[model samples]
Target: MDKLTSMNVFVRVAKAGSFAGGARDLDISRAMATKHIMHLEGVLGTRLFNRTTRSLSLTDVGASYLERCQQVLLEVEEMEAAVTHLQTEPRGVLRISAPPVIGSTHIAHAVSEFLKIHSDLTIEMIIQSSPGDLIDEGIDVAIFLGALDDTSMFARKLASSSLVVCGSPDYFEQYGIPETPEDLENHSCLVNWAIAPRNKWLFKGEAGYTGINVSGRMQANVADPIRIAAISGLGLVMLPTYIVGRDIEKGRLKVVLEDYTSPPLDVHAVYPHRKYLSAKVRSFMDFLQEWLEHRVSVIPPVME
Candidate 1:
């Protein structure tokens, strides 16, 4: 009782001018082709084909129905083709969210490079310290650092950056360098309040992991402010090496507690969970992964 299938068979039979020929083209038995045409005729309550011993031909009603069926089939084919193209080619506006420091330094470049390759795609980037609600914000992908808290979304690890506790040479000269994690309690540490365990920092020692509660005169929700404060000799700040690497190289900041390594901050691309991911989201995620692999040396060579 599939009306579309019946219509298709009818059109094939009409064009072929023989029930056997139509059945052969459709890979159906001749009897099944006759049955499909009969089913269509029953629905319309009109004869679709005039059959004689020697040949068969379409009736006036059959001619009209065949023309209409051809149109319908063509439209269905077009719809399918459009969907196929969407599956293969990435298009549409890709909404992304990321932390301000990472967004400005790394993601901005990646996005610019990605746009150069994908001419049809448009990008909207939202840079903030807080990881906003992806669904409410209509975010297609969220670039994140550290551990993922929300299990509802799908996350792919992009790269990992070493965490270093550093301060300006002038600041260290005044406040003195911390020889151990315990010394941080006495030092004025500029904390990134945006990250969890705001006043507390973790470090790995010879024994094991140690957590230290820190206090400072300055605190901010973003890393850039903390980084600037550290550079300006306001206080010591702990940040990813990617952000502080150049500063350290230039002697604007000096890392402390070299033996006590902090946990490496892992970067990830998170998206809402769905049965089928869109081509735009998938393509961008893949591109970002490859881009980070080539662009950032934050991750250790052993890990690579």
Candidate 2:
């Protein structure tokens, strides 16, 4: 009779594929379970289950309802846990979104470490260029690089990453190293469309800030391809130190224009504003900020 109870019973029946099995799991009688499902169907004006003596199956509409019901039940459980303050330790699946570069490298490594500490929690990492609609996409946290455009969602500054312009030994040998940002026009500068001002690379020097309109033989939407191309001596690339830091350390790439400084981009952990911030998200936000700070101190932005 109770809506939440009926929903739970329906979910159990749908999962177990039999009224008796679901009732047994819930410690309720088969008739009662059937009554709950019937009550739900009556309220919704649809048949939730296709009945038979041997097999039980859900109708098309019932299948959709089952998914929604599961989500609702999970939220209700989390809400109660939060209100009671019984969920201090992180639990449940944390869905995160981040750009491809950081997602695969830094954020992914942070999650591995976080999971080791919080064994009760699970994580789902979504790697994409855009942050997208966090609420609509069901993202619990999104690691955002650069400036925050949207003012609606809540964001916490995680860390800042400096940018570097670099190329392979052979590329520098063949094309000559760029002494100033103006010299980039003479060389092939691999472009990453994901970064704003795709055609222009900004730099600050003794003179002042300058935006150089650069062109290249190759350009990609994501940084990896362009980075690889730069490593192969195809062109020079200007990218955040986080993305190219290891490469510079490994001698795979060489940093040029060391005298100049490009504006550092601030990384932020973004999430939709909610009345109750889940323990998992709160813990991760604090953990990641501290983690990145330690990592930055241990590893210099550029080897050269």
Return the top candidate by lDDT. Answer: 2
Measured over all alpha carbons after superposition, the RMSD of each candidate to the real structure, in angstroms, is 3.8, 12.8
Worst 10 residues of 1 by lDDT: 295-304
Candidate 2: tens digits of C-alpha lDDT, residues 1-304: 7999999999999999999999999999999998999899999999988988899999999999999999999999999877566347688899999998778777888899999999889999999998899999999999988778899999999998777899999999998988988998899999988777779898886687789999999999889999999999999998888778788888999989988888776789999975578889999999999978755423354322
Task: Quantify how close model 1 is to the true structure by its C-alpha RMSD in Å.
Answer: 3.8
Worst 10 contiguous positions by lDDT, candidate 2: 295-304
Query: Each candidate's TM vs. the true structure?
Result: 0.86, 0.69
